[model samples]
Target: MLTSTGKLLSMGGKPRNKSLSLPFLMNISNTASKQMTKLRTLQIGNVDVIGSRFNGQELHSALCAEGFDSHHLVWRKMGSDAKTTEIDYPFKTPMNNALKKLESDLSIQSILHPAPFAIALNEHFRAADLVHYHLLHTGWFSLLGLPLLTKNKPSIMTLHDPWSMTGHCSYPRSCDRWMTGCGDCPDLEVIQLMKKDNTHGMWKAKRDVFAKANLEIVVASKWMLEKVQTSPIFSHFKHHLIPFGIDLEKFRPGDSEVARKKLGIYPGNTVICLRATVSPFKGLPYIYEALEKLSTTKPLTILTLEDKQLFKDYLGKHQLIDLGWLEDSNLIAEAYRAADIFLMPSTAEAFGVMAIEAMASGKPTIVFEGTSLPEVTFAPKGAIAVPMGDSDALTESLRRLIENKELRNSIGKEARQLAEAHYNWKTHVSRIIELYEQVMSEKATKANR
Candidate 1:
């Protein structure tokens, strides 16, 4: 529970003090410290974490509210609706055009789309005290930008997904090729969609980039930390584990019956909510497979955040309610509250923010054993985690929960407790502040030298 700052206070609590310690000195340290120190700001660059319903929004907003002078450097401003200033790079180079054509021709992930306007962005680079880089595969940032970002300021890159460490795919599902050097990709055509394999070249390019840039890594989950540590590219950097946090007040428990009524679910119906976006790795099919096995006495209404047509082929028998990609967090929270159980059968999830949102709403969530879901939700206590791709286990778990109301209530209580204990936005932002302090200290130390 105690941090380094806490240890400082703990040491201060005792009688042993420095010879220079004085009440007057302490007041000056607290009061006039801000004026004494030059204005400090962290320049945050990302593809699209700022102005969107993305997982990083809460942390970004919280930092801004805490008087942190933060600016978001984005590409195209994908979601300009969320609260944040998105400064986009408008210039393009011939190399950028060539890379764009190459990306289309090779069916590669954004390899080197946006060429950095070094001359144009010189002022930004010089003024920034620190750089916090989020997702960079969005055609806005390139492997080349790493050198520029790390040249002057301390750069912290948050590992939101495995893309930073991998060759091509964002979530390399069971593919260890990324570790050794991604070649002969298991799903070559499926993932890369190329006649000729370029995974080796891709992996080598990223490895070279990491070698060129000095970056501090922050993993959002323990699972992510383990996976990223295996990469030779990132092995040499400083790594920290910091889970994504949620707004507790907005996502708290509400009346299930009221929520169910609002969502138009009839009484005696067991509701299951699936909020997976349209990604193959998200594993939406597992939910459908599980549903095919369940023959419940209670009417089963499956609430899907995605398009209903995605499940139309399989969910033929059951009642399906599609909210169709919610932008409002309140509505999403209501849907979570309305559901008796939340289903996240993802084969590969980095942090599972949807699962966190569901748990924060006091719902008993179900996820696969592998990947970050189990660790993020605190399995067996906060949520039920089954073996990966085991729809039968998921079906049985759902059946047991539906049959036993007491078990559901107890788990829901534990889930809410887990949300408070770990996933609160306040806790996440405080840790970020700690990291920022560490970065500033290093910067000051280097400057003094």
Candidate 2:
């Protein structure tokens, strides 16, 4: 229950629900939520392109559906969303672009990017009753302007990755330097790489910015929330764990026979679908090793999205059907529907939206442990998880699903049930709306006091 001051109260004065369950989010009263319909919301993030950007776009549309005067501001415009406005990055000349590249190469990323300050001057930001930010560190918004952007607003930031807390790199692979001041980085070649080791200085700069910033943090998984709790830069802020949701209706279980016919795949072949990415964090080496170990009498058809030719060498013995960067969500959902099993063995994921999408499509998914995939997918029940980089275990799990039809059916059914109960798009929007209202109410109480 929510108190008059908008603070969440426990049932009968007990502790409140803290888990990423739907029931906790449902605690917000309908009257409070209805009041938020007239609220103006401004969401800022990297433009809607692929990955996490799509999540922001979905939320923007959902808020509009809920009658909020919602607007989106992005660093660039990759999609044709009418409500979204692109930030004005000055000096788009050739020399300026070269200088920007040089700055990024030196690891001074987003410092020269004017998107953060530009957002403060944006009309949408000025009129917004509540402000939400996502994916700000993707070579766009600088942390230096975060304090100014959020100073007098009821602001919330959805931490899509560990990038906000860390000095450099989105994922601190095997490096504990981020916990400390982050000096002397072991690997400068990590994503958002810094050619020079100014990690300590960068870390200190972020810490200073965070000290002056008034923002509530949201994480999609317990693993990510744990990361936030441990970070000296962000440990003081209020935190919420809300799992990412998917379109249950669009990605629901479908007939494999019909889907295969639509995709032109052999109806009798056992199909395994996966998003093919070249990133080392995705654990593609383990996937290749696991596929090599699988000894099947019949050739297994490999279905891939994004890059197609990455698996061209394995095409002779095993069939490869590459969907090649699908822009249409319906087609992507169909790719999931056509497959009997889905593989997303990411080694260092914050959260796996694809795993849940596969689960919603009623396909048994295989993932590796030590990341948020297991928890997000409800491991050993909705999805199968093996030790990280254990190709043997991955191969064994794949073989079990391929050989046993009953096991696949059982797991797929369970995955679908969990996806329906927990990952509904409407439920996700409702949770976010409740948070917006709570933040506004708290701000009001503070002003009254």
The number of the candidate with the highest lDDT is: 2
Q: Per-residue lDDT tens digits of candidate 2, residues 327-427?
A: 78899899999999999999889988889999999989999899999998998999999998899999999999988889999999999999987787766
In candidate 2, position 97 carries an lDDT of: 69
Off by over 4 Å in 1: 1-57, 78-98, 106-109, 118-125, 190-195, 313-316
What range of 10 consecutive residues in model 2 has the weakest lDDT sum? 3-12
Top candidate when judged by TM-score against the true structure = 2
What is candidate 1's lDDT per residue for 192-268, written digit by digit as tens?
34456777877888888889888778777868777766788887777777676778888989888998888888787
Q: What is the TM-score of each candidate against the true structure?
A: 0.85, 0.92
The TM-score of candidate 2 is 0.92
Q: What's the lDDT of the predicted structure labeled candidate 1? A: 0.70
- lDDT for model 2 comes to 0.81
> What stretches of model 2 exceed 4 Å from their correct place?
1-30, 49-55, 89-99
**Model 2: number of backbone collisions:** 0
What RMSD, rounded to one decimal, does every model reach?
A: 5.4, 3.6
